[model samples]
Target: MNREKLPVLLDNEIIEIRPDQSLLTERYTDFGINFINNLEKDQPFFFYLAHSMPHVPIFASENFKGKSKANVYGDVIEEIDFNVGRLVKTLKEKGVFNNTLIIYTSDNGPWLNFGSHAGSSGELRGGKFDVFEGGYRVPCVILGLM
Candidate 1:
């Protein structure tokens, strides 16, 4: 597999990521919260939080690890849930909750090769690779201004 050289940009600056280091989902949470907090009460904003976990090489921050009954995968999902709660709270406090819309989704089914680290397709047959429901019918939750 040929991997393309992609740049990681933050604030218009490219940065390096350590291969051994885990990417915490909390950063995405913080970014969304900060983005919402900085906006004016009447200002319209759009924040798209695409979490990279509950997938492969899954990770939960120190605070979330060992807090879930399922495993690391569950912990990552829990952390994501916590972040969503924080975003909702921020939106409500900023008086934009009623008008704001939040959509949570995944690009594909769970990767099962990692054993305990993989997520469940839940009642669906097959997994990330097969043509069954588990392969294509992943979970999606939509909240706010529905």
Candidate 2:
């Protein structure tokens, strides 16, 4: 869930309440890895991983907390980076690395109003809720496509 204080639902069922927010990234990564491991070699599958991190009320697992120079926000981002690496490793181990298409991007710009807790839009104007470029522009990366 976006808010750690709320319950997490799976298929309309409550899976966890007040779960350790720090492990959110790890748990999501685990779910992706597990899905990949259970798939047949020729079976086509699509996995959508959405992470609720670096958002308001940020959190980082003990392994990554205070490990970044950019404070909690950076810690959360580092955790995400580490988890993405884990997923890539799993894909390679499952022999689907070259055939899989991976698309990574953000839904919107950072919440600049949050000050140090938010991300930088660089030279772009405005942020998350604004009508300027930073509000709508986001970064996208695609892999495994010729």
Candidate 3:
């Protein structure tokens, strides 16, 4: 195995921020502020904020606990939607919303067995681990940029 560039795990400072938990957004919002502040202002800032949600252990934020068209998955999705909206809202409020490029994506398929907690992993076979559409099939959405 190629271990020369193996990452130095920072288990000490890395705290578990569950997506379904409110702490996740708090953690993200804190870093989001820092991220914007760190931008040089003259150069364009490219940001990619990918957070796990509507996945497993489906836990919705306090505000969206019981609000949604879907079930737990829907509630979780709405929570994710809130975060995405917040990012855009921040950008717009800062007047840089036009120059920013935002995109959201998922890595793999959902665990069908996860029942409603799982997301639409696309129509493939197997799941999480398999050489089927259900495994590697995924899509991306691009906005604010070509």
Q: Estimate each model's TM-score.
A: 0.85, 0.93, 0.73
True-vs-predicted CA distance for residue 86, candidate 3, Å: 1.0
- For TM-score, the strongest prediction is 2
Candidate 1, 25-137: lDDT as tens digits: 77667877888889975887677777767767677788888889989888888888888888889888888888977777887788878887988878888788879888889
Candidate 1 residue pairs in clash (backbone atoms < 3 Å)? none
Residue 22, model 2: lDDT of 83
Error of 1 at 130 (Å): 2.2
Cα lDDT of candidate 1 equals: 0.76
The numbered model that scores best in lDDT is 2
Q: Rank all candidate structures by their lDDT, best first, as comma-separated numbers.
A: 2, 1, 3
Please write out the lDDT profile of model 3 over residues 48-105, one tens digit for every residue.
6655465565677777777977677877778777777777777777778788777777
**What is the clash count for each candidate, in the order shown?**
0, 0, 2
Please give, for residues 13-43, the per-residue lDDT of candidate 2 as tens digits: 9898998888888998998899999998779
Task: Write the number of the candidate with greater TM-score, choosing between 1 and 3.
Answer: 1
